[model samples]
Target: MEPQLLHGVADSVATVVIHHPAKRNAMTAGMWRALPPLLDVLAADPGVRALVLTGEGGTFCAGADISSLQGSPDEAQRLAQRAEEALAAFPKPTLAAVRGHCVGGGAQLAAACDLRFAEEGALFGVTPAKLGLVYPAAATRRLVTLVGPATAKYLLFSGELIDTPRALRTGLVDEVLPEGELGKRVAEFTRVLVSRSQLTQAAAKEFADGRTDRDAHWADQARGSGDPAEGVTAFLQRRGPRFTWTVPGPGSA
Candidate 1:
């Protein structure tokens, strides 16, 4: 099949699949540009309460298509950083369900998500050093935040692959599943994510990402939102809460 990003929404979860298995799912220049707008559409859809990013077939993305970088590595970096920022800023819960290799730009995309789950034996790397390209500054900061300065420097400087065990220990990946179990766990976790309160998740996501000025905004959101009340009622009644607050699409209040 042709290389592309395939996406679908089911049961309030939007799944974005990276397809390019011929080159181990490496993304081309066009795929880099396609990601942000696709994420926007999904983020804007009220039906899409959470998102999962993954690769097709066995392997996750190996990296950028090296051939695409022959023309201009700078342009590739630009598009990639843009895509990464978009994923990081996505208001709802986002998870990277990874298998096989998640290297270079693929690792950047995965790190942008709120959480990452890798299958055992999956390998990961941040590989700008291999191409002699300076990784984007914001991307570097994000990496540092995820894995701390020492671990981040190790990946950024060495450009060597780390096994899933080390990645998990360093907080690069949130969970490492045994082979054949990654998909099941991602589905189960994302179902729980969509069942929760968007008000709480969105606020917590922003705060966790270091946007502290939004406390007042979220406080107002909670006041207007019925989720808090519903949560209490559900606990008192011993039933699951049907949260009513929905995240507005980009640019909407």
Candidate 2:
């Protein structure tokens, strides 16, 4: 199939599938360009409480379609940076459901998500060093934040692939599932995410990302929201709380 990003939403979850199976889902320039706008649409949808990014098949992504970077490396790098930033800025929870290889730009995309779940035997790498490309500062900092300075340096300096165990140990992936169980775990976990209060999730996302100024704003919002009351009532009644809050606006948090 032609390289593209396939999108879908169901049960409050939006799934973006990177499809370039001809090259193990390597992203093309066009695919990189498409991500921000697609994410905008999903973010604006009230039905979308969370999102999952994954590859089309066994391989998560092999990196950029090298041809996309052939003529103008700067342009390709800029596209990737923008796409990565968009994912990081998404208002709701975002998860990267990964399998097989997730290297270079693929690793960047996965790192952008709030969480990453990989299958056993998956291989991951940060490979700009191999291409003699300077990784963007923001992406580098984000990677460092996820895996710590030492582990991040190891990956960036060597451009060598690491297995799922190493990725998990370094905190690069949140969970490592067994083979075919990745999809099941992802679906099960996202359902739990959707069942909870989006208000709490949105606020927590911003806070976890290091926004210290929003504490007051979130406090006021919590006071005004019914989620807290419902949560209490549900606990007393022994039932799931019916959370009614959605994000107040798009492109927030």
lDDT (Cα atoms) of all candidates against the true structure: 0.92, 0.94
- Highest lDDT against the true fold, candidate: 2
CA lDDT of 189 in candidate 1? Answer: 96
Q: Which portions of model 2 miss their true places by more than 4 Å?
A: 251-253
In candidate 1, the residue pairs with backbone N, CA or C atoms under 3 Å apart (3 or more residues apart, or in different chains) clash, namely: none
lDDT of 2 at 184: 99
User: TM-score of model 2 relative to the true fold?
Assistant: 0.97
Steric clash pairs (candidate 2): none
Model 2: per-residue Cα lDDT over 221-247, one tens digit each: 888889999999999999999989888
Give the clash count for model 1. Answer: 0
Off by over 4 Å in 1: none
In angstroms, give how far residue 138 of model 2 lies from its true place: 1.0
